[model samples]
Target: MPPMVVLSFLDAPVVTGPARGLIHLARALPPEVRLHVAILRGRGAGPVPPLDEMSDGALTVHEIQERGPYDPSILARAVAIAWRTGARVVQSHSYKPHLIAMAVRAARRVPWVGHHHGWTAENDKVKRYHRIDAWSLPRADRVVAVAQSARDIVVHEGVRPDRVVVIPNAVDARDLSTPMTREEARAKLGIPEGEFVAAVVGRLSHEKGQDLALRALAQARAQGAQVTFALAGDGPDRAMLEALSRELDLGLAVRFLGHQKLVGVVYKACDMLVMPSRSEAMPNALLEAMTLGLPVVATRVGGVPEVADDGEMAWIVEPESVESLARAVVDCVARPEERARRVAQARSRAAERHDPARRAERYLDLYSALGVR
Candidate 1:
């Protein structure tokens, strides 16, 4: 049998960011490195069905009960699972998975790492999440940050700087992106060909700050620059943003298209992508839009500056300043040539920065260094 490796994440198969990253990494690994994934808890018993049938030697996934930090019983269960699967190394992502691995390390005796994937200190809920994160990171042999910005958090919270690995989120943008015709794509997406299009391509929530983006676009449209805004993705704040839209009199101009699975289509469909997130770890949506050659107008928070160079690739605005964002949007929409240049620059740069093959090779180096079985 190949050298077995155990991987643990919050979601067993399908999840938004961290889980998807874990899945793709397994596929990219050499086949000789056998893999298993464990999930701490789910809505009910067993692995989620569709993915359960799909997992095998290359990926073995499971779910189990867990309580507070470093729950010994749960960690023991994980160690047993790894042992039976012949796994010689264990890796974990997110909070509970990391703690359990840490708790049971004596028994498992396997080299392990924690892949921290969120902005833990920027807001309230995440700070609570980071308390757990802070507790667990030191116990691991390696600590991986999805962005340099993410690494800053742990280091500020006082994790040794040397232990942190800043490997960013990676995607195959070359396969995912295609150059688009603005007139044709606008017609396909049901927007009039000449109308200025601005979009916010994430959940309508506090952290994402979609409301600010919408207000900015509304202000731009009010200036007699024909404009339309699309709020793509569904979340708890959908109704709130809708109410704010009506109160702000941004009817028809701002359309809410909920939870679009084909987000790549969103990139091609919009003339510009706007992300005014108050905080982010490393935004996949923004990266997606850039890869598809859409000019991005986003807030300079979190890992955004790492990807977008203001005026070179995309416009970077301060968070919560509706007027500043409005000014940037108006400037771009007024000049067609400038928009095209910005789009081209953004597309090429996004591909260069976040290539999955390059990220996978980095993980390969980390795994090899740890002597992953």
Candidate 2:
């Protein structure tokens, strides 16, 4: 039997949600099922995926460094790589990979699985890609939606509901199960011992709503909440977000930590995780925070509500409401006993619902049903 080929098209190998999920999936795959990963347009900064490390010697990686997004040569190379490797099933992430997989499937008659990680479509480029995905997904043999929200979009866009499956992103529950204590984690990160720290981990982008979090933090501090905020990850909106922070007079109140590779330490160090994303699709930050037993205050958007429980695992707030966001953070900060209780319940839920091992088994089952031997 040929190996399963997973295609991820992104600028780099960062610790984003989709990348992390792929890493976990590769780690948990059975030895009999060899895995090959192809990164279209090559790697970027940040920690590379541990595919080779995790899959032992069963994983083969192929990278095609295209000069730009519209590079025509990548398509040919990707198709050749899949056909040469005898890919039984080509699972694709994002629009570019979907097109590549489509071409490969057309040539080889092999099945293609489209993986949806949700979309922003905020700009023209993303909008065009979303349009492409909308058209391409229905043609895929199977579509793996990372959340119910994504699956709904897939079904709404004309794909058969039976052909689309929802497989929520997985977190390594074992890593979070025995992480460092909050105090120890804070000490390691050089955070003050008594500060009420809130972590917002995601690309610093408008859609991610990091600006909203800054505003909320500013409001909470103005009301004498005695809190500090940390913005993790980098993006084009960093300058704008920094400017907003300055405008809000959040000089020392906010710290911009640029894409920390050790994201686990960031989760552990924070007193609570705040995800004020105006849009989301099963945010790995929220899931990881929940799994690490960190109290979360997240906006009720997209797949967040699907993945987190309101008032049980997380404090769900309205999207883009600075007041509501601030109030939730302040409330979470004030209630330690409640936080601990929620953490216990959230940990149990995360282990049951989002464990990497279970996620891998589900993918393997999906593969079997898809005729991958």
Candidate 3:
């Protein structure tokens, strides 16, 4: 028999979070299962690295040149790729790709499996496309949420609970947990040694609360905390964050490193991982950081609670409050022994929960349980 095929569509190049999770799952599957991804666009409108180019072993990636951001043509092209690849299971990652998969499935009568990555539909641009999600979601054969919080939203929004599978995020930690020293990682990136480095990883956006982190950093510095902040990943909020950094006179104290290829290196070089997201599903960066044994300080919103308990892993602060967040950072920095113990616990938990091989087997079960709708 031919291998069961999975067709994936992602919005970005770096392939973090659900994208990275899916790739990890795909790579862990048996040889009889074939996986191919069709992305709308990649890093920097940059070249879409071939499927084989980025694979660790045998996973294949097929890239498509997107016309523009959220371009309709990309969705249309995805359908063509699905047919060309002889895919048995159509898996769509991003929201646009979900719509595209449903469209293709509707025409071809194929099972459209959606992996929900929780794109913000409240945006003005996405609000214009409200009808699209409302229309496609009900028709899906199966939908997987990266976080239970995401599943709750889909279920509350009227999607069938049975149809939505709550598969929380998982990771291939062994690959990410490189045995590189912090000094070497810092040297590779030219960061000064001995400075207290606080790293926040995510696209710099309002929802991500990168700006909120900067505000908290500013607050802590004003209170006589000697620290430098580095932000990884870039997005629509780049100019705004850069301006905010300067406005706060965070010169040289905060640096935007842009999108990184080795997030493991970023995690290792940091003293702690801070996520001040106003809204999120379970962020993969948070999981990765925990797996790498770094203490975390994140807002208590979305699936963050699912990743870290209030006093476990790292500090969890109330959302949208700079004062509370600053206190949380100070608390973590002051209690180094407690923080180190928490990091050890977090790494242990991450190893057990997100074991790539185990999660991939669950995905296989999901596939077997899903039939044509």
lDDT of 3 at 46: 69
Write the candidate numbers in order of decreasing TM-score. 2, 3, 1
Clashes found in each candidate (C-alpha, N, C closer than 3 A): 2, 1, 1
Overall local distance difference test of candidate 1? 0.73
Model 3 TM-score, all chains together = 0.90
Better of 1 and 2 by lDDT: 2
lDDT of 1 by residue, 1-373 (tens): 5554655646333356665565556666677665566776643445453333333333666766656444567767877787777666667777767776775566767777787776534467667777888888876788888878888887886678888888888665533444556566555566666556777887667889988877887788888667788888887889999999999998889878787655666666777888888888888877777776778888988888988889988889998899988888888788889988988988888778777667778877887788763
Candidate 2 TM-score, true structure as reference = 0.91
Give the per-residue lDDT of model 2 (tens digit) for 1-373: 4445544443346445665666677777876666677865443433446556644544666767766647878878877887677777787888878888888888878888888888895689889888998999999999999889889988998889999988988887544443578787777767877777899998888889998999899888877788899888999999999999899999878888888777877877787899999888888888888877789999989999888788988899999899999999888888899999988988888889888789988888888898876
TM-score of every candidate: 0.86, 0.91, 0.90
Predicted structure 2: lDDT:
0.80
True-structure RMSD for candidate 2: 2.6
Alpha carbon lDDT at 214, candidate 3: 91
Error of 3 at 325 (Å): 0.8
Question: In model 1, which regions exceed 4 Å deviation?
Answer: 1-6, 12-14, 44-58, 65-73, 120-126, 174-194
Query: Could you give the candidate ranking by lDDT, starting with the highest?
Result: 2, 3, 1
